[model samples]
Target: MQPIDKILRNYQSMIVSGAIILFCVIALIFAVIPSVQKIQEMFVQVSDIAAEAEGLQKKLNVLNALDEQTLRFQLASVLTAVPGDRSFPSLFETVEGVAARTGVVVQQMGLSGGTTLATPSAAKLSAADRKLGARTVPFSVTVNGSISAVQEFITLAPNVRRLLRIRTFAIAFPPDERPLTVSIEMDAFYEPLPTSLGTAKTILPELTAADNEIIERLGNMELITQSAEALPEPFIGQIKPNPFVP
Candidate 1:
């Protein structure tokens, strides 16, 4: 009903105010809201970083408190008791050592199960072995000795280092009071070392009293195999005043 010019003039202040408010709303939608979202994401990243740092600090503190020598000694004992791989040489040495100590003559030996030339991969393990997390190498050994010596051999075989379990055994009596022939079936246990470490946030496992007792018992076991030779010292190249100058 009114002229355009007149209506605009009458509502000029109100229109300017509305335009300012609309501009603010558009800015909030396009810029301010995005900025707020970015800030929130940054806060989340910082919190994650702080948590990771705290976890790493706790691990460092635990490492610092540990005695390296004692840990290494314990690890050596444990490895000797239950080697990380199927060490056939050490296993044979252990069996021979025990038989020697028990006054038994080893007549024959043969590997019963699995390939003796190479270690079996984890994929080749049976479901039960995978679940148990330990692989077994079955072998059989035949020995000739007096009844008392054979009994002692049987007793000592499982308790020696390079851990073994007697699965089955049979004895044959000779007619003329000769030494008895004993056939023993055994299984040696091995476990592979972990291929990867846990995440920084993962909690370190604490050794319980039972674990300590096991370690102590392993330490006391007779190590039949010879100790491994110490590693050679690392070579340090001659230092030059300027490494760039050949």
Candidate 2:
């Protein structure tokens, strides 16, 4: 009876401690571990899915963009000409073609400082073969044509191999004897060589701009974005799931 009592008293604390530890372990495995493991697995799977989807989307975009650019591209071209070598004949010929086709009559053409100088002499020379003036000659072209024909001529002028600019256009609103005749005064600007893109970056003294706000904004870096078209998005999120549970 005495031995049994002594053993029970001394071992009582150990027995209680062991019971508490076992209960905690059971609770952790049943209640906490499953939830933690599920969260970790979900996170890993979601990350993998997101990565795959992103890669696929990028590939599709690249392929589609390539196809579009190759087949149907609409881009503006900056005219390049052999500056001083450009002659009035070629420029005049281009105007003549457009004007004649559009039913515009050229009454008088001359070479002058501004875009408008009526030059009848340019008709005799060839485009690549003629030189209107040394370096850049300011010439004027006067055409007796309708408003539509005049507009067509201006549009066609830039498409010519030799660069020409519409410095000023003066239309006969009240008009002379010919009511449909609108006089166009344009400058045929020719340089020695097509100015380099880098050199063109700088506005030269001879170069001129119009009061039109749109033209003033052309090639202005302050008004433009110079970064690459295609770029990557930055890191957005970082989520960590329980490691021990998995």
Local distance difference test, each candidate:
0.81, 0.51
Give me the candidate number with maximum TM-score: 1
Model 2 CA deviation exceeding 4 Å by range: 1-80, 83-86, 114-135, 175-177, 193-246
- TM-scores of all candidate predictions against the true structure: 0.79, 0.34
Reference-based TM-score, model 1: 0.79
Stretches > 4 Å off in candidate 1: 119-123, 126-128, 193-208, 226-246
Per-candidate count of clashing residue pairs (backbone under 3 Å): 0, 23
Question: How do the residues 1-246 of candidate 2 rate in per-residue lDDT, one tens digit apiece?
Answer: 889889879898987898999999998999789989999999999999998777667756655555544222111111222223334555556566656766678777776543324333332343422554433445566776666776776776654544556666677665355545555555555433232334322332322345223233322212111221221111223233653441
For candidate 2, what's the RMSD?
Answer: 20.0
Give residue 6's error in model 2 in angstroms: 99
Model 1 lDDT per residue over 1-246, tens place? 468888889999999999999999999999999999999999999999999899889888997898978877787778777776777777888888888899999999889865445544443775545676778778999999999999999999999877899989999989988999999999888775554456757787777899999999988888776554332221233345664552
Q: RMSD per prediction, one decimal?
A: 6.0, 20.0
